[model samples]
Target chain A: MTRTSDRERRRDPARIALYVFLLASAAFFLLPVVVVVLNSLKTMDEIRQGSLLALPASPTFDFWRIAWSSACSGIECRGISPGLFNSIKIAVPAVFLSVLVGALNGYALSQWKRPAADRIMLAITFGLFVPYQCMMYPTIVLARTGGLFGTYPGIVLIHVVYGIPYTTLLFRNFYAGLPDELTKAARIEGASFLQTFGHVMLPLSVNMLVVVGVLQFTGIWNDYFLGFIFAGNENAPMTVQLNNLVNNTRGEVAINVNMAATILTALPTLLVYLLSGRYFVRGIAAGAVKG
Target chain B: MTRSKAPARGLSDMPESGFRPDLVAIGFFLVVALVFYGSLLWTGYLSLTNSRLIPSYEIVGFDQFARLVATPRWRTACVNLVILGAFGIAGSLALGTLLAILLDRDVRAEGLLRSIFLHPLALSLVITGLAWRWLLDPVTGIQSVLRGLGWSSFHLDWLADPDTAIYALVVASIWRSSGLVMIIMLAGLRGVDTDIWKAIRLEGIPLWRAYAQIVLPSLKLTIASCIILLMADVVRSYDLVIALTKGGPGFSTDLPAKFAVDHFFGRANIGLASAASVVILGFVASLLVPYLLIQRKGRA
Candidate 1:
């Protein structure tokens, strides 16, 4: 309190007003999560009373357990665990392959600098802007033709293909910011492209790698549309199952269980964001500003 | 720039063999290029033909487009796209800029507040949709809560009402995206010249006037990029709608993306879906061309 200057004390009214505004907006942002989590803890009867924001009269983890294990989907009573496993399988490989390809593409662009590369880069990046709907028909056809349809590999390939543009943009901007002297010095030592990349560039790019990894992990995990379309029934991701559970339309509504499922499904990405909050911000800045 | 010059003058810059390409890099490029261009050409071909449940390559020359235009559902979807796009863009921009400006004054716990605001970006649109759907559901959500507080006339059932469903989509989307807009704008604000602030203070300029006349113009590039990004989000919007309204209450909130998906999957009308997709690409390309060109120029 002693750090406050006389001038700052004079502006206390304005400062307090701004704080009120900001805090209200923050509450607004968190309201849905609060409501969802609170209701998810309640029994079905409590939720049926129709006051979602109410503190549950009797909070329990029943719905959470049910959502994780035995919530009904069609005939079977399998919960979202299968979809969770499927999502992990899809996200891990997709993130690894996409980030790897992006690094290579970025390294080539920044270091190799072919005459037509810039134009080609621009066109490929343009692929990011295309709606998946436009590409869906052909992609499904291609997957079928290649015998990858309704398989994990098919979904992973789509994620990798689509993930490249933004990752390439991020890594390209990153590598572009680095000094070329290192690469030139390595080359003068008779080092080849792979050697220069392995010894010099890759070591320098550890920070960007973390940033890209976080972004890709969050993205690939949260994706529902691609996983819904490509991953087929047995391999459907958590989101698709969550959607089925919550938005089934025909089943008896289980609001608490649905809420619990939503929370459970979103946990992985939410945890990622919370843990790597700073790198997440950096990733967004790099992707949006550069891409 | 210095790095480019150093590399250009080096002996290593010379081709080992005249005009040799990096085969590995080119191979990656070719695969990506094939997917992108291949999809574009294939989708275009599908659109022009009489394709139905499967590909019928016999060209039918815009019959699908005609059917698409004539369909009332498609028309509703297009209208919803316009309404949703306009509001989502404008609402997120205004809210994001306001938050950014407020944040610029150097409040306490700024980092924590920022993280709270932006944490939504990490969540999937499905999560956003489901959470908002519960909050907006009249029987189960805020409306009932309001009534429980003895405000009997409360009617926040936008999620179930056909006419107002699109607005719910806009509200949820703005919630999901305003944080991103805030971060981008904050970055833009930080880039403002300190001398400009000092000049404004010396002249005793009002805060709003300084931001409106001076600060905003300087952030034209940032604002443009934000708008373009927001537009792209609008075109690509799918998971949100799927999880939220499901284009329900008589298809009033139906978007073009949802329309394409329904036609492609649920309705099994591949030609019509492809046509919708191509139209979406047109809108996206119009927005992206200038953006990509400006970005390239900025880098140069």
Candidate 2:
């Protein structure tokens, strides 16, 4: 770190060029968001007259209100509000179940040395690599046979099932980082598996819960395909609604309203990124490094 | 707490006092194994059948596979997958590595720039698609914007043209994913040995050569991981295609995952869809096996 700062102290042409390149690239990376936000606040007439880079003639929040309350998505014109609630309804339980299950799996894998445990873990991790499309057909059939197709619980269960592999990998790696002596001492003290896990492992996993919660909530909340396919029209999540709002061409294309809806749908994950991006990166790194 | 004095029982023995916690993990794994793996095997079995809208129990051998091979739309979708995967992975790797190097130079507003670059990853692909679609539209998009600025002859209609629509997917995907690669590469760069830098400087070696010859060789794992991750995204790329083109412009931008979905839900060809899905899983697994092997070797 000091090396970088010391180099920065030197006034070199290379350093200046590096800064220029970074600034330009940063603009490039941020261009889409800037365009959406700028145009979203402008009237259609103003947008037509000006380029995407143009500033709004008169900024307004009307589009935001309309997108939230009354944008047309197919025959239903109730806007993204219901979808927002549905997403929350799905994400809350899906995140809770997936994370809780993952934490338990991690504790058990770390504490108990069951026969074929490694192979079972390997199979679960391999499941992570299998494309969701591969499982779509049978999953749909299973949901139908069990009478869960196009239901709220079906979508939630899909998220939980899919999320288990990732969450299990995360918490397992997290628990593996702790000293095994803690478990050994707990066992030696006559603590049964459940007792050791509750008293020792669960308390130690508090921070891991935050990591898992943030990951699962953001993923499930932003998910579109599963919701579109399995959650049914009534329970379609915000992402599906956003797609409907943006891509549905039956009505007049209101660029402003569409952009506002896009931002609204993306807001939850964006906030999580802004707030806990470091942990997000850590979670990804854990999966990548341990894979 | 007073039970500390008692002899420890068998590790697998049930607890006499409280709830059985082992049941939580064991049961969850059991169900996931049944659901996830069982689903894969079931899909494979379905692919061999003559199922249409509804699944059939009678086997049709490789007839569905033969149909998949002969279908022009399926072939186009497979070709598009390769195009998206090749260009998307290469573009992200190059751009991300460059961004990482630039950030490593201790530029001003480092934190702010990093956040700006990384924020795209936080967004869902649906938003990325919508945002880019508007920006790339011919009439109200960048082309018009450029024409409005006196470049009246500017022509940028990739999204609408059949030949260029798949490229549009490539662009949006790279934009959405490059930030992840940048962050990962930056982390890898940070782990470089300081002594190596000092040695290179003492020998008056140029910075680029030092990185090319010494530093990058050590970051092989990071590079491989980036490629593997990007390939996985390519195989699972359904949302971006759906929100962008919906496999339109005469099925020019059709991808395997999107094809599977359209067949399953829209076209009602369960057998063909299942076969396409198995092909995607096979592609992804081919890439992942080496990654898993490398990880195991690293631990050993």
Candidate 3:
């Protein structure tokens, strides 16, 4: 019994140490966002010469307003709001289409078996590694050939194509874990191919749908390289606005506005994550374990 | 409830009477594969020819490859990639693991903490880069702040200094990457069997010891995968470099991706870009092969 209390005493310090170390570590991770948020409140003059940890002298919101409205992204000075809207337009449709198609493909692949199934799956697996850069020129060539270049549909198509591999992988794993009997029962009830997918497979896939949505949402939304190269200057996304904001800002740097623009560019995904952290985490866990 | 509904289910042992057309699915797969793969093949072919602006029939026979290999900036990019890969992966893993461990202890508002750690993963490098530029600007950022706090002699101009720009890029990148590692590590943590903790309690094993010896080793696959993803990010990091520095401070922090982009579009040197891309692809493929083998082993 004496030994047991001694062990208890030992465990006591260990738990305390764990808590201490972990809290300190959490603080470290929180620093950057804290810095970004704080910086957004100060003026350029204040930010340029102020301590990183210190609150703004007047705690103004001018930088936030300017970064959202009047900031230059290259030669234009429309701020990052235009790009934010483009991201929304690109993201909403891309998510719905990609996720819908992905669910269908995953359901079919997981439920059906044939020589072609493996071949299709293998082709997509390889697609994941093809590296978009290699495909960029040809996509352009194909786009121009097809008279689709510099168009909204053309860029959305690119997102959908690239989005398939990740989304398919997500839904495939999810459907694999679903009960085969549900599908079997539906077929016995005279359910057609489309009906089985719509009523049986998709209904049970809410968790995975959330997973696919968040991934695609973050991906198509935050995408910079593809959007830069393909979306054209007219349809450039939020990143492009932020890029313009960063690139064209001349000397005597406007640090406050820059920080605010950065914040604005990241706001949508940040807002979504804020609202749906659980769904995102749940989706990730589902995808990772299955992946 | 499901068991009760089971018998009401209309399922049958007999297979469906007709073959599903599945043509739409098949066509979708074929079309995407052809386009994506066809482009890659074209890139490979283009890399081998003496072409500029468009595909050409003139065969260069590795001249572009030879020129690419001989270029100092290209060599520097290769070296820089390795350094960024190692440091960025290592740094993020360490920082993320620490955050994961901290957040695992039933922290108050664990959800909020987790979100904070993950916010960076969803953000584009364009914004993150711009933000960091503001934070790191020598005349206007923290340096000036420090100097204003009256350390007039302090020198913190790494972003401006050619000697240290790559490292500065690594620092901003770590901020972008470590959150992913944290989330991944947290998932790995949740998978740790409760019985292991029971065993540790029975044996009176130190928490740190159990974590280091057992938990850390168990996370080898997670760590490896995180490393590979971070490495890939560093390798393919073009936008971040473009937004952050634009290969500036005298092109000190140039990367292969940026080099490829500049040659392909900016400089209109398609042959050089293709050659450079082919090299980068080869390196990526090699790294991936071993990593895949490791993953396959873990599967077994």
**Residue A251 deviation, candidate 3, in Å?**
8.0
A198 Cα displacement, candidate 2 (Å)? 2.8
Cα-based lDDT at residue A213, candidate 2: 89
lDDT of 3: 0.76
Q: Which candidate is the best by lDDT?
A: 1
- The DockQ of predicted model 1 stands at 0.60
Residue B184 alpha-carbon offset, candidate 3, angstroms: 1.7
Cα-lDDT of candidate 1:
0.86
lDDT of 2 by residue, A138-200 (tens): 888789999999999999999998998889888877886787668767766778667887788
Order by TM-score, highest first: 1, 2, 3
Q: What is the fnat value (0 to 1) for candidate 1? A: 0.61
lDDT for model 2 comes to 0.83
- Candidate 1: chain B TM-score equals 0.94
Which 10 consecutive positions of candidate 1 chain B have the poorest summed lDDT? B12-21
- Which has the greatest TM-score? 1
The TM-scores of all predictions, comma-separated, are 0.96, 0.94, 0.90
Tens digits of per-residue lDDT, candidate 1, A47-98, equal 7864777898878999999999999766557888888999999999999888
